[model samples]
Target chain A: MTIHTKTLKQLSQGLQTGEYSSQELTQAYLNRIQQHSTLNSFITVTETQAIAAAKQADALLAAGNAPLLTGIPMAHKDIFCTQGIKTSCGSKMLDNFIAPYNATVVDKFNTAGMISLGKLNMDEFAMGSSNETSFYGSALNPWADSTVPGGSSGGSAAAVAARLIPAATGTDTGGSIRQPAAFCGITGLKPTYGRVSRYGMIAYASSLDQGGPMAQTAEDAALMLQAMAGFDAKDSTSAQQDVPDYSANLNDSLKGLKIGLPKEFFDEGLNSEMATTIETAINEYKKMGAEIVEVSMPHLKLAIPAYYVIAPAECSANLQRMDGVRFGHRCTDPEDLNDLYIRSRGEGFGTEVKRRILVGTYALSAGYYDAYYIKAQKIRRLISEDFAKALETVDVIMGPVTPTPAFGIGEKTADPIEMYLADIYTIAINLAGLPAMSVPAGFIDNKPVGLQIIGNYFAEAKLLNVAHQYQQVTNWHQQTPKGFE
Target chain B: MSLTTDDVNKIAYLARLGINTEDTESYTADLSNMLNLVAQMSSVDTDNVAPMAHPLDTIQRLRPDQVTESNQRDNFQAIAPQVEEGLYLVPKVLD
Candidate 1:
């Protein structure tokens, strides 16, 4: 049996039943990664490390003491710092940077006995919506070579969608995980802001950044998230709440489940074809005993503006540590301190990253601080309130993950505004610090569309239950790319 | 609503990012487009709404001051471009 085709749950059972040794399974996935190198999904493949870890897992299985995730070869978004691995946040600035420590999320996964195949590619500093901004070249969508795999977490989504790996870790500062998952037609979750520890997961926007699981199935996502979530002392913003077993409620029935369809989500900017696809998926939910209600979030339109400001402002501050003196790329010849700083950052960062840093600096500058930064903060409050008020009336919010399915790679790159608009539907949930996910709904023009599920703060399990229940009735999540299959 | 070339240069200088002279025109235009997008925030009336700094609206959790980390200066500085005596070397700040 091909190990790549098995879901995380099925793989766990297979390991437990001696169907395949973890070493063989790990080798199978490594071989597939070699076979699909043209996808550009992986930036660094840890072949030696993965094989050694797989051997350890095989020994554990021989002792009948294997963890659920033992020997499961997976890829991590390059944003997560892996000890002794090159952790390029898809920017030339970090192309030479080797992380000295593992991100807390990486530590958690490693502790659970999951073997990492390597680091996946992403948008530079998790700044862009399309994978095109990656310094390592765009991660091509497995479905269509010309189209983009939605980014910041684009590589993670693409790898999972193409069945290169069963699951991968992704961070969502603003719809990075969910949007890419939508574009790739996979299951991706963005947990409540503090649900997952952000320590060593290189900060894009400290307040908005969150790490979650990207997998082919919601049930697989549930298993992966169970290991990734929880508080850590390393991350000061980490919540003090207990993480619920995400898989516990996966089989829960959707009977009497209340799903809110945000009228704003279906309004202008949503593609007509995507709307029809989302509606069809909602009807399936309706058939599964879910009640759909219309909810209004008037300030939702302002989310993009507020996010563009606040996220960059935080990013400008967070990325300041990358000065030429410390670990990261540095200019070869610098006339002075300012020249070193300027040239290093200029050469290291990509166009999108520099654009953001410039905008962020301008917003937080002496003259524009109140007019831009403070004003945007207030808009953020209004946006969060819109979500809070809506959640009070509904159990969860449902919407289209993107205006359209994965567009051609170079289509939106020329217009930054148009590119930013691609995340319009997914950004508000980030501003509100709510849990949300993208699950495969249906295909439009042979390109997959995702149904976005937005849940209240810490409502991750509920969102997974909704997606898992839906996945049971539909085969959308199982449709792999033509060539990859 | 739009940033002039001078404004773009000043922002880049403050951000410590050097832009090729030829790219300045595009940067000026792109930054202006982003600013125009952010200009949407000004139209909303946020009179009573307080500026939110954090999502949870919680105070910073204070921990007792103590040394919690072991010395990894050598390991940490191993990746630095230039390090001497455990100190990162940058162009001199003071003449």
Candidate 2:
């Protein structure tokens, strides 16, 4: 197979053995990205910058002092600021905004000499579940042209799944990374909230936003997460805990692993076929000497209502920086200061963004604060408590990543509530600040189903261990989309 | 829980986002739908539960009162839409 089809680890090995130079590998992926332009996976293609970075990697490799990611080419979701690159966060508001500095994640990857292809597209400010909310056109699922690659990390999922790049960086707030990873038949990890720094990653919901890895396999994700996970002094919320070597425990046996299946995740709204696919994957775990326990997260149904209130409220606060001022889009010839602020924001933000800001503003408004904002926060506590209780008895929780496989583009746009329900299975994990992953399980009507594996806080190594073991026995993750190959 | 157009108008004004006259109806409908969806929170009793402002509930880490960054006003102001003499230009706030 060509270099573009190789796993990230395989590419690293290839570079080490002199099979291809970093420049050659970078060129190969850039060519594939050009070939698959119709997928709209990238918001910016840094060909000139990528070539220079790859040359630098080649120099390090020549000296036999290259780091693990020395020559690997990857894409970052548009949310992470790359110094001097347009970090739009998939919104028109920052369309002209060239990042003045690098996000902590970008700095880490650059320090390891990783070559970035460019910024990948995403939901506007990472708000939508379906990427349909992106100001840049929605990224298409490589599995089916008409279907959406899930968002707010849609482009990251699409590019990685289509093999335009071996892997990409993605941020998950409410199932953005995992859902798209499921729809696109790839592996995605949403690390525990504070595990990754949020310094220059454009904020969506401050408490829920987290950056992680999306790749073709659990091993690749583990490798990427190794570099991405660490505390930065710049991010006030960064955890002070020591970073663990994610790849160190990937080969651990799954025998005696206690997996919890939340009843609410498999209840009424789940598609029957999708549930069956998840069941088969669970049975595979059972055959591997793992024990499955049924657990109840009774307040999981409250997650959506709570998340809708809390996320928007935080989003409204977080996105207030985009008003026409020092930076970002400015409306033409404003009559006054108020006119400038209102018109610039109104014109800059998309429909879903506006709707969210409005909802958030209303929720946090004086008279409604106790009724809506505080109530949602109380419900958030209950949801987190439920996960905390369930996780005490089981090593990990297993569920469907999304309620169904990929839905067609434009299907749920008119009804925002229907679209919000797509994230039902995944949102509670975010609310609880737990680490979770989505791995390819099987297919439904030719679309891939994702088996979501959620672990307790700081349990990324265990999650990767479980997923790596499952991937060793099943070929689901290795399956590539037809035309993309 | 249904929000009227007037309510939406007030909310938009509070948010400082201008809604075009033509799009007001749709914006009102969309905002109302979202509010209705979130209205379920009020039905659940949360009398004694403490409001969670953050996930980990970690307090902000305070650093020593020392300067960590050097002045880069020129570099920072370079990206501003309108700037003059290292100062960001904005609409007149007072006479």
Top candidate (DockQ) = 1
Give the per-residue lDDT of model 1 (tens digit) for B1-95. 87789989988999998899999999999989988888888788998989887888877788899999999999999999999998989887898
**TM-score of model 2, chain A?**
0.99
The runs of at least 3 residues in candidate 2 whose Cα sits more than 4 Å from the true structure, single-residue gaps closed, are: none
Query: Could you tell me how far off, in angstroms, the CA of residue A204 lies in candidate 2 after the best superposition?
Result: 0.5
Report the lDDT tens digits of candidate 2 across residue range A259-374. Answer: 99999888989999998999999999999999999999988888999999989999999989998787899999988899999999999999999999999999899998888888
- After superposition, which runs of candidate 1 have C-alpha atoms over 4 Å from their true positions? none
How far in Å is the alpha carbon of A437 misplaced in model 2?
Answer: 0.2
Per-residue error for A144 in candidate 2, Å, reads 0.4
Alpha-carbon lDDT, every model: 0.91, 0.92
